[model samples]
Target: MSEDENQISIAKIAKKSTPYSFTVNILAKLHRNSYLTTIHEKKSYVLGVKNIWNDHNGNHATLNIIGKAPLTPFNLDSDIFLASSEQIKNSLGLENNPEKAIHLGKIPNVDIIASPNIENFGRLFITGKSGSGKSYTVGVVIEELMKKQVPIVIIDRHGEYSSLKILEKENIPDNEDFFIKNDTEQKYLGGIIEFGDINMNPGADLGIEYLLAANVEDLIRSGSVIIINLRGLDIPVQENIVMTFCNRLYKASTLREIPPHFLFIDEAHLFAGKKKSDTVEILKLSAQEGRKFGHNLVIITQKPQLLDVIIRAQAGTWIIHKLTDLNDIKITCNSVEGLGYDADEEIQNLLPGEAIISGDLTPNYPLRVKIRKRYTVHGGAGYNVLDYITEGDTLPKSEIVEKLRRSLSHEILESASQEIISNQNLSISDLYHQIDALRQENQELKQEISDLKTNDKDKSLIPEGEMKEKIIDNLAELNSIPLEKINDKMMNLMEERDDAIINLKDFEKERNDAIFQKQSLELEMSGLKVENEGLKDILSKEKKRADDAVALAERAVAKLKKRK
Candidate 1:
């Protein structure tokens, strides 16, 4: 190779004289820990890859200055060379700058560990496509934190993290009942606090108001791994639960009611999106100022493009996985530091369980990490399709027949039974119980008044008559206003409850109708798929015939040419 081939000036590279491929090759050939010699404002300074970039205007190697860089008079155009180990040390101006780091995983094919600096672990934003192992990586992080005894509260939308209770994946039972019932029936690594029903798995048993009034403190005080499971609930109900939780947490943090802990929110884009909402407002406030109050947020989402701008900007760390969407990639590149347009290709090509770690966590440079395996079983690994193909052998034929009969007979009843047992129902029932007690008391009081009247008319009790009269007057005054008000309020609540029940029933009917239509559509789609295959066969035959005709014409043309 000629010396000139290896002797491209930084100025020429910056001015688009060097091709993009050549520039990439040069950088790739440089030592991993090497520093680039560049001049800014006539002052010589060594910069890292994060501070350098291949210009996007054309094939220029000009750096896209991110945080700090000279605007003009930067003249390090001389031939670029790799900085020695000593030179890199001197450039960084560090002797022994050491701190704690959280060991995440190792770089593929390298012994060097990929652990982020602990002190700068402020807020993390984790994003990836569905099934890209983003949640699995979160499990790995949580397990590490658990070892450190750092409190964690997860806003689990799909109830995937419950598997964290087990020490490791191998402890999972092999019984089908274990999977069916969603039970581990084994010792847990740490205490698991659940606010929702055990039967339902993931949902708010009571309304949002009830949770705020009751469970928020319990959630804050519990040092265990807390999971606010919101699976299987309606979107509005989920929003309400999250809104209430955020509001309480934000307010309490401001008052220093809770200690420093991690709050991992999955599907963060749903709560904090382009549209403004009460939930969004609280989340924004938390992202902006909650760090000061020790309320650290770990926002997780599959869609980075939809996440709030303010919240995205506040994240001190980013764990990006594979993303195919153009907008998602664009937003991720723009949001994260030490990344550029070139990084998009790497992101798109990232394998499952692999991620690019950037930002304050890894300040020196971005780390391409293969996420370590989880200690706990991954509940999010969806059911295998093969499992359904196997025939069931557990039940006798008679038992199976009985079960089928029962299911068929109770189909409508089972649908009704599926309604969530909400706190609203309990509250209405309690109100009625109170009203019934009040009525019984009123009847006893009336009977006593009648006896008192009879005794007063006969003069059998003289002194007691005046006292009885006073008591009667007091009772009348109390019943006259307060009792009437209570009755009116109870009646109003009952009417409202009735209306809500009616609306719920109508919604259920609509849902059932939709399900029926979906079933019908699926059957139609099956038929259409079979028909489509038949059509494809006929088209292939027609294409073969046409090819034969074209071949015959070509031969005929060759014969005519020879004759001429």
Candidate 2:
């Protein structure tokens, strides 16, 4: 075949021993590209394209090739196989403008590129086991989209996206392609990428109210990325907030003329899992109808089987990394069309950064792809206790303790605040009951004190001798007592009565003060009620004025139309 021709017909293999390794005759100058594959012995072998060599004098050409493994030599036959870059590109249906396409990574050992366009926004599902570089791959995609100025909303369940603020330190010692030059200080390389973090935890600087009050659609339309951090929040609260936000976003997207926006739900299975929740329902609805409104959903989950099957089916693209679960592997195999049995085995053995990409974005087949390195700092790194202890050695013990104390105190205060808010009304009712009981007790004591005082006055009016004689006569009827002993008893009773009177007086004063405070509280409450009523009236008047203004504007527009 001539070099000018777009199509090259190469020699076919006579026999093959294995699936990945096979021999084929070099019939023409066929350069290595990902699309070149040899179907031998009822199995496919990816003919890894290495390089395209042409004669310096334009007299000859050389084709260098590689494969997944070493190949056994086979007889070269007259049978011809056709390979064409134009045919491959046409089949892939890639975008015409490279600038619009986000570069994921290069196709393995091939000149052919794999960049999905922005217009291809739809449900994208990424699944992988933990520590398999799932979040890292996601970071790469997010950075690419950010460079394109596409707005992203991430449901950060673990506070993993906060590190997007720090510049990524690429540590590929020998790979210069991954390194960023010091002179090139860009947003992707550590400069501040503008993002709003809405923390679900009450103690955080930004709370749920901020998220609710902010114009989410406007933020996205203006190309702002928002991260809703659900870390440190109860599962129920997380679910409620996620459901509400998604519902609002869907409604707003439907109402407005806006640019395409992406909603990335990390750990998506929590929201759209086996158990039913409002969040799951909202996600389902969004997955079904969101694409039409330019609202794309990117779901990242480790548990593919646990995810809602309908939502999974809605995905137009899937980036599957290393998964060990048999059920998850089966589900993945079934989801992507044209994934071979051998590919299923390969899924279990895939390296951290290696993945199999399939769906609408691929070339009508599952493609083995090496995920590109991230441009943003990876926030999902695992904790190392020893490393933390060593780092702590640099600081004074007191300072470290103070920092910990502050953190703990803030958390405690947040917990206390939430508890107080939940039970404030109940606490007021309990206080009212306690105060009422005290008032009733005080009234009973006042009556007893008054009776005691009257009795003392009656005793004082009688002659002392006559009172003594009466007490002795009463005591004598029960048991005879000496005159001196009776006198002492009478004296003790008088002293006890006086002490009771004094205590009663103190109780009365306390009761009067309580009554006065109650009266003051009542008056204050009445004034508040009146003020509230007045505010309501003002609000109604303002609403009426707004309606009238709208009516006047409508009338003016109608008159202008009539004149036209």
Candidate 3:
């Protein structure tokens, strides 16, 4: 090659601008050491790293990593994955008797425990390079739960993880239980309520309330998963519903037996926020006490930074996937260390479906595990639809349409049900097919229509402020009430009505008792008056008798005198 050509080629190669293909097997791995040294903002520290590398001349070049392992650095060499993550801790003289957890591999061919445990109760943390199966990991676990009869409640955003049909490509029983499909072939889990929609407009409130009864029922019953497909929703709404859902379930669970296993929050960072969200209290219940109550939670996310320390700390179990980001690795590992555990050295370099499981969920040792394969029916066989479509020919419309229609119908049903449950007054006017406006002017009055359309342009519109003010004034004048306080007023009115009903019943009972007493008193008074009158009549009669006797005596005396 010419000198100039060689120089240009070398420069391109150095910059990694040249495109080349290789068998790149980027694995997801973890280490408790990867999660090292955390300082509240404004704190800084150095970390030690081994086997750390960067690309140089299209070859792997090692870099100097500042790890808290405090391990002494050896001479610079290409043995990058050799520096133990623990060395840094020792260098810093921060020693603890961290029990040995499971030693995990990058990729496992079987389902094995990362930490030996009665059950994997630890928080499963998902992290990976882009397209490295971060989302796929969640789908895999969910499919497993579906098969095992363990139910889950998911706050799914982005619609990525909820696409169970992709698994059907390999035919693993994706429809044993079904989420209703929409008219557009979008399928959601049947009765698995969704919270918000990102695709629709602002006013289309995703009816979370619609799921209240069924959702609460599901929790009480247990053994059924409530998958909430929260696709196309804004960030704040996602946070609110997730936090709200978990909190509500916990509060309710305290009063009753809740569903087995807690919930899964996919893309958790959105709601985890910069710090712990207002919903942290709810999340804390599931994270800490879920297992004791037969409830468990799984939070899947590629972005670990959004998670607050409480979730990170309480998750007890962490199924950490591959995270190459230095910050992410440090935070995930150090978060574990804070819990008085000292085993972050071995699990961070895992491949797809492999993680260093930690916390109360796993054994003291990290276990290497391969997720079970999903079949088409269990949300499809955990295969990519794009790959299936690309590999095969399309079936006839007859079969295709039926399949698509079935899926879509199910999704629509699920969606509509969710909406209705969420809003008692939601205007579910109709479920008509989406259609374009009709334009049949061929044999009609085209000119008249055109003229009317052109002539009826009204530009004189009132300002929104004026319109709002008028509405407020009119409502106030009519009802002597403000719009803001309507709900409170209505509630008060209902309370008063209830009280009035109780008062009326009591009053009727008291009046009946008083009437009985009055009747008794009248009877007694009448008897007394009658007795007194009878006495007077008897005395008068006696007096008359006495007077008659006196007359008789006088007559007798006169008779005697006559005889003499």
Task: Give the candidates in order of lDDT, highest first.
Answer: 2, 1, 3
Predicted candidate 3 versus true structure: per-residue lDDT over 310-357, tens digit per residue: 666666656666777666766776775322222234434565665554
Q: Highest TM-score: give the candidate number.
A: 2
Name the better of 2 and 3 by TM-score.
2
On lDDT, who's better, 1 or 3? 1
Query: lDDT, candidate 3, residue 397?
Result: 24
Clashes of each: 0, 2, 96
Q: List all candidate RMSDs to the true structure.
A: 19.0, 30.0, 33.0
Report the error of model 3 at residue 538, Å: 99
- The parts of candidate 3 lying over 4 Å away from their true place are 1-118, 165-209, 213-215, 218-220, 337-349, 376-564
lDDT of 1 by residue, 1-564 (tens): 234433433333233322111232243344332345543445554444422344545332333222244445343234454334444434432232333546677665534456555667779999999989899899888866665556677887766775664444353235422122243343233244534433345222222223334434445643456676665454555666677677788888788877677889998987787667777888899999999988899999988877889988999889999999888999999989878667888899899999988887766556678887665666662212123223652211212223323443344434322322222212355579879999999999999999978877987555777978998999998878876578557645754664586498569957987998899999999999999999999999999999999999999999999999
TM-score of each predicted structure versus truth: 0.53, 0.54, 0.43
Ranking by TM-score: 2, 1, 3
lDDT per residue, candidate 2, 288-323, as tens digits? 999888889999998898899889889988899999
Stretches of model 1 off by over 4 angstroms after superposition:
1-99, 169-188, 202-217, 221-223, 381-564
For residue 72, what is the lDDT in candidate 1? Answer: 50
The candidate 1 region of ten consecutive residues with least summed lDDT is 393-402
